[model samples]
Target: FDQNPLAQMVVVGIKAGIGERNSNLSGNPQDVLKSISDRHKLEPTGEPSLQNSIKMVRDSME
Candidate 1:
């Protein structure tokens, strides 16, 4: 679960694995995740990455 304001903007804070895509967004969640991951030096695996998770959570608090 991501908490970054950018992640919220990335996917509008929607939970994953629901089959439904993020609300009020363009393209797919995979695309969003990949971009987010790439920006944070993650592997863009589409699944949760430890680095991305930490970055997102930490970024959100600021």
Candidate 2:
């Protein structure tokens, strides 16, 4: 489904969770990156690209 509303909701929820967690942190760049990586278990150049996309969104929010 190209326009799945559920998928959008899930993304928003994820971003909100990330933002909330980030707000409580020290805001150190490396720490934030590591936190995201650890929480999501992200690996480089994966098929889904969700990790990079989430990271980019998180970076923009900062």
- List RMSD in Å for every model shown: 11.8, 14.2
lDDT of 2 by residue, 16-39 (tens): 223223223333455545655565
Cα-based lDDT at residue 29, candidate 1? 56
Best-matching candidate per TM-score: 2
lDDT of 1 by residue, 6-62 (tens): 443344221231122233343455667765554565223344345555565466558
Which ranges of candidate 1 are over 4 A from the true structure?
1-25, 42-62
> In candidate 1, residue 25 scores what lDDT?
43
Q: How does residue 40 of candidate 2 score in lDDT?
A: 70
TM-score of each: 0.26, 0.28
Candidate 2 has a TM-score of: 0.28
Global lDDT scores for all candidate models: 0.43, 0.42
TM-score of 1: 0.26
